[model samples]
Target: MFPKPIEKSSRSTQLTYQALLPVALLLWLAPLIAVALFAIRPSVDFTVGNYWGMPSSFEFFENFAQVFNSSMPRYILNSFMITIPTVIGAVALSAMAGFALGVYKFKANLLLFFMFIAGNFVPFQILMVPVRDLTLDMGLYNTKTGLILFHVAFQTGFCTLFMRNFIKALPFELIEAARVEGIREWQIFWYVVLPLMKPALAALSVLIFTFIWNDYFWAIVLTQGENAQPVTAGITSFNAQFRAMYHLMSAGSLVAALPPVAMFFLMQKHFIAGLTLGAVK
Candidate 1:
């Protein structure tokens, strides 16, 4: 039922595929390439409406230097403060919940799992008003703690679904063997299940890290100014009352994208392993 492989396609089809590949690649990278180009251009280029043309002079180092010297650094730090704690909390809670749901046979187990899955289908926009109100009432509005807690709660539903499916795909014999060996339930989970979940954990961490790091909607919705704003929201600080600094905004965008990219490369092997492990028989 699979489509014919490209290599096995007709000669004309193969030629067309080869010709279109680079064009598609360029189209995909167009925005990113434009951003990178803008980041290196002098601010005068934007003021003179010279966008989409070659820069008159390059200010590569100067632009990035200005970004770092501004409140961008604090925004980066705030992003880390919010994202790291959310990752740890969401993954930890999901792993335990996944194990219980996947390994045990309770009457409401499927119902509970479905609830988690259903939450993922609900758009976050609908919850925005109530969530913001709740944060305000709890005196957490405009605080990093508020953002962290909200992210963890919202992200856990998806994380639990991921972990639960991964755990279910694991061999059940391992748990039975541990139990037969007189191991306690907690010991079995600690020593046996947790070790096997490493690949999934690594993959999930990278995904969640990218999600929270790139989050702009919630960042703007819940926070304002440099004190609690993440890089995504803080990038707008490049705008003045009457003028928008496109060059600096592009530079800040580039800088803000680096951490998650670095994280994926660092965990590349584990991330791939986690995704592909259960795909084969």
Candidate 2:
């Protein structure tokens, strides 16, 4: 039912795969390569239609420096403010909810879990209008708090799914033993289950951080300007009234991408472990 492993493939097949890998890699990275090249080029290069050609002059430091010299710093701080709170709130709530749903055997357990899963399948575009209206009604439209709250609510469903499954895979005997030893339910959860959940928590934190950090749609829709807008939306400020600063935008894009990339690298081991923890029998 599955294709043979590359190691088990015929010698010719292996050789062909190796030959095409670099080409495929380059093709996949073409847009990124183009953006990087554009980020280093002078505005005159783009003005003279020298795109995809040699840069007339390298302005790497100038382009990157201009990005930081703008209101990009405020936007980045806004991202951290919004994303960190959303991550903590969503993960915390989901962990508790997942523990309850996974540990308890309530009559409506499956129904409730299904409800959380259902929200994830719904197209978020449809909610944009109502969400915007709701935010406006609550006077939170264009505020970091509103963005953080919305992200936490929106992401909780998926986070619960991830946490519930991970918690479910945990040993039931530990809970039973804890109970027999007169450990209170909260204590069992806080002291016993919580420690074991570190890997899953770390993984989910990294995932959610990346999601909220890279979020452009809701960032633009829910917030505006450098005061509340995340770096993703704030990058658009590079567009001037008369002309677009493509080089500055490209540099800003690269800078905006760093936190999530750094986060993933830092938590790479835990992320992989959390994902693969319950996979094996």
Indicate which candidate wins on lDDT. Answer: 1
Candidate 2's residue-wise lDDT over 82-188, tens digit each? 99999999999999989999998999999999888888678879889999999999999999998998899988998888889889989999999999999999999
**Residue range 1-281, candidate 1, lDDT tens digits:** 37878889889999999999999999999989998999899989988999988899999999899888888899999999999999999999999998999899999999999999899789889999999999999999999999999999888888888888888988999999999999999897789999999978988888888889999999988989889999888877644511477788788888998998898899887556544533542
lDDT against true structure, model 1: 0.87
Off by over 4 Å in 2: 1-16, 240-242, 269-281
Q: Number of clashes in model 2?
A: 0
Local lDDT at 117 for model 2 = 84
Q: What lDDT does each candidate get?
A: 0.87, 0.87
Query: Per-prediction count of colliding residue pairs?
Result: 0, 0
Best by TM-score: 2
- Scored against the true structure, residue 26 in model 1 reaches a CA lDDT of 92
